[model samples]
Each structure stands twice: as structure tokens, then as C-alpha cells.
Target: MRITRMLGAAALLFGLTVTPAVADASPSPSASGDDSAPTSAGTSFRTATEVDQGQRATASASTGDYLYWSFPADAGQRPTVRATVKLPATHAAQTWQVDVYDGLRRRQSCQYGAQTRTAEQGSATVELACVLRTVRAWSEPWANDPLPGTYYIRLTALNLTTADLGQPVNASVRVGSKDIGGSAAVDGSLAKPLVPGIAVSSQSDSEDGDTSKAAVLSSIEPDGGWTSGWWSDRWVWTGIGAVLAALAGIGGYALTRGSGRPSRVPPGA
Candidate 1:
């Protein structure tokens, strides 16, 4: 009876001690709101590999033309979108704009800025950056907050010189994200995979059977597979730790009971 009582006490003690430790060790979800981190990277639109966010690809565009790229983002992650446009010395000064949109095709307002004429020799470089805020889509119907999913970036050449018409201007873009303190509890798997946006001019190429032209404008690939909430991966490790702790407690209890037993005496004595 004493051994049984000791075993019961051991189990209870473990449950009281390890359970709270596990809970404390787990990360707590952040409150829903605009929890964006300070962004250092300037924004610009550039062609990049589907899997890589560092490598960039260059594209040439004429006046009044647009370039589009899509990137995946999760709630609580502050994603920064940037693009850089280089104008040749031969061309006159021009103005460009970068707009960000949500998965639902709704234009999301973001802080945008640009720096031009930073280079010498009459060449101009434009840099733009937008830092997104955390969004809770289900609760806030009136607010146009940024949510987790695929986001589209449209780069338009607002003002181009007449001499630069038909001349291709080089541009590059990249998207980066960092985890701010929060959790995307409301977000889940998307019903349909998000598709990358295509340039307006490239739309007619498909109908005209011009595969090459369409391919050029459709170079941006879809953002890879969906990512679960921040706590998803942590839960897995917590479960494994709990199981191991329970096994250790049981082994300790068994050894304690064995040690409490009286030693046997020899018959010859």
C-alpha cells in the first residue's frame, strides 16, 4: 500500500510540475492588430526565383507598361515589398509607382516612398518599400487590413519621356518577411491556390497564340505551398517532450519502489 501511494504521489507530482512547464515553454499568441516590425530594406519590384528571395531577375519595360509579381505571406509576419527601376542616361526623367494588392484583388493601402536621381551620369534609380501590418480578416469586415496569403505587387511607369517610348527600362523586385510577435490563429489553408498576376499587355498574347510573348510577361511563379500558423510546429515538439517526461517519471517511480523493498536473508545464516 505504501509503494502504491508513493507511485500515485509521483504521478501527481509530475503532472503538476511538468504540465505547467510545458505550457510556460510554449509561445503565447499575440493580440490581433497592427503589429508590424520596423523595416530597413527599401522596396522595389524585381524578378526573382520562385524558391529564392535573394536572387533577382531583370526585366525591361517601355512607357505606360506594368510588371506584376506575387509573394506568399502569413499573418503576424511583417512582409516588406521592394522594387528598383533603372533609367538609362539617354532617357529623360520619369516617375514610377508600386501598388500592393491582397489575395482578393483588393488594393491594400501601405506606406510607400521612392528615391530618384541618386545616381550620376544622368541615370536615375527609383526605390520603393511597403511594410505591411498584421490583419484579422474574420473579425474586421470594415478594415482593409493586410492578411496572410498571396499578395500581388503592380509596378507601373506613371510618366515616361516621349523619347524613351518603346525603349526598354530595366527593373528588379524582391519580397521579404520577418516574424513580429503574434499568431495567425484565424488563418487556415486557402481554398484555392493563389496565382501570380500577369501584365495587361500579355493578356492578348494568349488569344493571338503568341506563346513566347505570353511567357515573358508570365515569368513570375506562384508562391510555394501554404504555411501553417506559428504555433503549429511548436505543438509538435511540446507533445514529444511531454511523452518523454512521462516515461522518465514512470521509470523513476519504479526504481524508488524497488529500493524501498527489504533485503532477503540467507538460510545458512
Candidate 2:
């Protein structure tokens, strides 16, 4: 009974240490917005218009112009960008494409979607969508896994007729996200999303200055810097390690303990 009680106590300690570390996490507050969001698109990444998830931004642009918009993404999110271009009636077919990039400026590959499409000469509009991989809490220094950060969506004409150059068109883009919950949770996170330019703002201090000019041409970091994430798998691992250590100590005591240790006496004594 005493040995059973010791085992029970060890099991109870393990449960307490491991469960809360993985279960008590709360995601950061997401950026919010309505349908009609941005009024214009940025000419360059430095000036990309800020848009929140579920918000749509539209602007009048030329066929070959690069239109840009940016949004915040958090860990465990799979963000999908959808774009529509209403081209003016033309005699030549046109190819349009939408590309997404992480805050590091590395172009992220779409999981699957109509990222590029050709609009028939008489077609009224061309639609494009790019689905990004789930945002990870952390990735290897060399790995390009999509981590939480500001993501950019660029819309442009890939192959348009020479005569269609400078032709006016209407462009719109929208962003949405699906959370992966605790399934994709990890033991680590970035100190900050790969956004450049602005100083890493702390909760106490707001910001530094426009330092990203040389790096990103423009900084589109979130209003407040990203939080380093709330929960981690390290807690669970640590608890498990402690439980093993304690169990080892208990087992060693049980095995090594005997009737008594001889004092200066012979075995026969």
C-alpha cells in the first residue's frame, strides 16, 4: 500500500506539471476590420496599405502596376489571399497573378489555389487566390516556414498585351485566416516576426523610428510589436523530466535499501 501510494503521488505530480503548460495558452488578440477597409493600394512594399483579416481593399490601377496590401498573421494561422481584377474590355487576353510574401521578404509558396489566371479578351474579370501554409511559432534559421508576421499581397499583370499597357483596371484584395488551435502548438517562438525598419517595441515603450527604410523600403509592422507567444511545449517536457528524476530516486531507494549496513563486524557477526 505504501509503495502504491508513492506511485500514485508521483503520477499526480506529473499530471499537474504537464497539463497546464500545454493547455493554458491563450492566443493573442487578432486585428479586426469590416468589409470596406483600404481605399487604395500601395505602389511599393514600403507603402503597402494596411488591411485586417476579412477586410477588402479596392483601387483603380493600370494593367501592369503592382498593387500591394499587408496584414498581420499569428502562429497556427493559415492565411489565404483572394484577389479580383476587373480589366477594361480589350482585344487581347491578359494574364494576372497574385503573390504573397512574408515579413522577411521571402516569397511564400501557396499551398494550392488559382494564384494566376488568364482572362479571355472579352472576359469581364480575372480572379486569383493564394493559400499560405500554417504560420509556425518558430522555424530553423535556414528554414522558410511561414512564421507569425506581417504578410504582403502583391497583385499585377504577368502577361498583358503591349496595347493594354497603362489600361485602367479595378483591383481588390481580401485576407482571411483559419486557426489550427493547439494541434500545431510548438515549444518555441520568435522574439519578433521578421518585420524590419521599426525598432522592436516593448509593452512599456511604444516604438523607435523608421529604420526599415534601408531594409524593407517601408516598415509595416503591427501597431504594437508581436507578443513572444504565451504557451510552449517546454513546460510539458520539463515536467516529464522532473517526474522521471523523482521516480528514479524513489526506485533507487527501494532497491538499495536493505535490513542494515554492517558496522565493523564480519559477515558471520
Candidate 3:
């Protein structure tokens, strides 16, 4: 009975040490009511308009233009992107779509939402939306799980009549996120968001007004830089320590277990 009690205590201690820590729930993403945000979208990834979560972004462009916007996503968030296109008066039907891509430029599949819509002839607007899977703290190299990073949204006219190609159009995009909190946390988090470094002019521009001379990422970092958050690879070392502790408990129990009463030589001569 004493040995059994010791073993039980060891297991309980191990469980306590390795229990996954969870953070308190934080507020949801901000609302899209900020009117002061810029009202333009980028034509390409390099120039993608960066917006805060749930910020309203609008742009005026031709029917077939590709409008791109980017936003940061933290772990445990499920980001949903909704886009609306105000179409000019036209008799031709058209198809519009909004695609979400990770910072690696890899397209992420939408778990739900109407990602594409075909506007009927004379329709005033077309709306599309996408709900991405929950962001993960960490994932295996072979897995394509969504991780905390900078995500991009690309809106374009997928199918349109040739005559409607250059028709004037207006678009608005909003990205909102739902925080799932610590329920979906894993052993570690990414060291940084997969944000690209924007090109910056060389300091030589100070002497010469010409700003053409450029330096790549060598000098510039993304605004605020990247952070690892609370979770990190150190969890691996913690897990190893827990395992070693459990093993040591078993070894100690084996060395000291049972036969507490000193054994006398059985009927020693």
C-alpha cells in the first residue's frame, strides 16, 4: 500500500508539471467602424495595403483589377475576410472571388463562407467571403496548418465578359478575426510572423536628394518587428525535464521500495 501511494503521488506530480497553461480570454478583434483608415488597396503582394484587423479598406479600380490587402494573424485566431464589389451598370454577368494566402504566398483553403459569387446581369454588387481555419501555435514541417503570420487577401474578377473588362468598379474589404483562445494551443509558437521586409532607400539619400539607391531587407525591419509571444520552443526542453523527472521517480522508487524491515540472515548458522 505504501509503494502504491508513492507511485500515485509521482504520477500526480508529473501531471501537474506538464499541464498545458492557458491564457485568459482577450477581447475580440476591433470593429470595422474606423473611417480614418486608408481607402486604397494594392495591385500586387509587394504593394499590398496593410490594414489592422477589422479595418475597412476600399479602392476604386477597373472591373478586372486585382486588389490585394494584408493583415496580421496571431495564433488561436480564425480570420474571416468579406469583400464587396460595387459594379457599374452592365448587362453582362460576372464572377468575383476573394482568395486568402499566407505570408509564403501559398493559398490557404477556406473552411467556410461564400468565397465566390456570380452577379447576374444588371446586378449592383457582388459579395464574397472566406473563413480560414484556426491559426495554430505550431505545426509539423510536412503539415500545411495555418500558423500565426501575415495573411493576404486577393480580390479579383474571375470571370467577366470582354466588354465588361474595363468597366469602372468600387471595392471594399474587411478582415475580422475570432479568437479561440488557449483551447487550441500547442507545444510551441512561431518565432515570428512571416512578414516580408519592405524595400528602403539607402541612407546615402541624405547627402543626395536622389532616393533611387536602394537597400533590401539588410537595413529595414517590419514595423514593431516580430515577436514570439508566450509560447516558444522552450516547451520542448520543459517536456524533456518532465520526462526525466518521471523516470527519476520510478528509479528512486525501485531503489528504495519494499522490505523496509531490515532482513536478517535466515536462520544464519
Evaluate residue 81 in candidate 1 and report its C-alpha lDDT on the 0 to 100 scale: 68
TM-score against native, each model: 0.50, 0.67, 0.66
Worst 10 residues of 1 by lDDT: 34-43
Which ranges in model 3 have alpha carbons more than 4 Å from their true place? 1-29, 198-269
| Model 3 score (lDDT) | 0.75
Residue 156 accuracy (lDDT) in model 2: 93
For candidate 2, list the clashing residue pairs, or say none.
Answer: 46-218, 197-212
| Tens digits of lDDT, candidate 1, 43-71 | 33334223223334346666567676666
Report the lDDT of model 3 for residue 60.
92
- Cα lDDT computed for each candidate against the true fold: 0.54, 0.77, 0.75
TM-score, ranked from best to worst: 2, 3, 1
